[model samples]
Target chain A: DTAVSQTPKYLVTQMGNDKSIKCEQNLGHDTMYWYKQDSKKFLKIMFSYNNKELIINETVPNRFSPKSPDKAHLNLHINSLELGDSAVYFCASSQEERKAFFGQGTRLTVV
Target chain B: GESVGLHLPTLSVQEGDNSIINCAYSNSASDYFIWYKQESGKGPQFIIDIRSNMDKRQGQRVTVLLNKTVKHLSLQIAATQPGDSAVYFCAEVTGGGNKLTFGTGTQLKVEL
Candidate 1:
């Protein structure tokens, strides 16, 4: 079984449109994270949630919000999406400071 | 101001040969380091990891070396195969938690 999975592997939307990506982990991990990989293949941390509590929030725009309903799920919602939002969004989960397991990633294309 | 970066953007190696990818980080406080391999249309896969206390760690055919004094890290692969061709990234974690700061990936091409 896939340790971590994200829905809508590919997303294509117009600018100003709102979209959401859903992530779930079956590894029983307490910490989950959202990372953005640009065309240059530079992965940057966007948000981190530990046991349903927000812990790390990067300099991302206000349009981006992450919600973790429980320790098993973390979802990302983007509002007023701009063209710059185009990139591959990855979902990762880990136990404490251990190595993180990543999902297949969702490619978001905002035109 | 803390960032992890790669020295070479790309590396080409022959099959059955060894390959080395280098990374540099500006964060001296980082205690944990990991290397990830990403293939096309897939997320990064955990390859190997090392802590600040250890200078080297080996996994399968991959090895990770850390130099705390210079804040540098390297991943060495032995007998690289064509299937090993992918983009590799080095990530660091500081102050614990799950926040992993990844470096710019290096494309590894294993020629058959």
Candidate 2:
């Protein structure tokens, strides 16, 4: 079974449309994170939530918002998606001070 | 503003050879370090990690070394195989939260 899972492995939409990516972890970890991998393959942390508490928010565009209903679920919603937003999104979770496990990743394509 | 960066952007090696990927961090406060393997169109999978207190840690066929003095980190994979061809990245975490600063990454190509 997948430890961390993401939905819609590939998303293609218009530049001004809205979309969301969902992620879940079955490992029962308290911490969940979202990372964006650019076309250049540089992965950067966007948001991380510890026990449903908002923490580690990068300077991502306000158009992109992350919501964590529970410690096991962290989702990303984008408004007015832009061309620059075309990239891969990954979900990860870890125990306190422990190694993180990642999901299969979702590739978002904004045209 | 400090970030983890890699020395080489890409490397190629014979399938049976060894692979060493280097990373340099700018944050001395970083207390945790990890190495990840990312295949094409896939997420980054954790390979190994080492805390600032230790200099080396090994798992399976991979080894992670942390040189806190130089703010440098490295990952070594023994007997690189064709399945080892992927992008490797080093990550650093300074606090207890889940935030992680990742290196630019080094693409490893294993030639058979």
Candidate 3:
């Protein structure tokens, strides 16, 4: 079974369009996070949720929002995806602040 | 934002030799650290982690060492193989449930 899974491994869209990426984990972790890997392969934290509560929301654009319906799922939605938004988005989880289990990542490409 | 950095952006080692990757972080308050290995076209896989209190931790074929005073971290892999060729990243986590800052990553090329 896929431990942490993300849907649509590749997404191609136009600028000014809205898109969303879905992630789920079966590890029964209490915390989940979203990270962005830029072209230079720099991974940065975007948002995080703990027990379905918003925890860390970095200087991410307000156009991007994260929704966690429960402890096992977290989704990222972008209002207007620009070319600069083209990057690999990863979903990860950790229990009690241990090692973070990450998904394969969703590669979003804005055309 | 806090920054994690790697001393070498690229490293090449022959197979059967050992590999060592180094990282430095600017945040003194950071206590938790992780090393991730990412193969081309794949997500990063957890290699190992070291807490600030611990100086060393070992896994099957890897060892992570941390120096809290200098905010330095290193990962050593024994018997490096061609399959071990990948980009290794070092991440730092503060005392929180989230927020992991990753370095630019070191491209490890294991020569056959």
DockQ score for model 3, please?
0.67
Q: What is the C-alpha lDDT of each candidate?
A: 0.93, 0.88, 0.90
True contacts kept of each: 0.71, 0.62, 0.67
Q: Compute each candidate's TM-score over C-alphas.
A: 0.97, 0.95, 0.95
Instruction: Please report the candidate that would top DockQ against the real structure.
Output: 1
Off by over 4 Å in 3: none
Model 1, B1-99: lDDT tens digits are: 998999999999999999999999999878789999999999999888898799999999999999988989999999999999999999998866457
**Model 2 over residues B1-112: C-alpha lDDT tens digits?**
6988999999999988989999999888777898989888678888888888999999999999888889889999999999999999998877763567888999999998
> Worst lDDT window (10 residues) for model 3 chain B?
B92-101
Distance from true position, residue B82, model 3, in Å? 1.3
Candidate 1 second chain TM: 0.97
Q: Which has the higher DockQ value, candidate number 1 or candidate number 3?
A: 1
Worst 10 residues of 2 chain A by lDDT: A94-103
How far does residue A97 in candidate 1 sit from its true spot (Å)?
3.6
| Candidate 2 accuracy as lDDT | 0.88
Model 2 residue B74 lDDT? 94
Question: Per-residue alpha-carbon lDDT of model 3 for A1-111, expressed as tens digits?
Answer: 999999889999999999999999999999999999999899888988999999889999999999999999999999988899999999999885548888999999999
Q: Which whole-number lDDT from 0 to 100 does residue A30 have in model 3? A: 93
Worst 10 residues of 3 chain A by lDDT: A93-102
- What is the Cα-based lDDT of residue B2 in candidate 1? 94
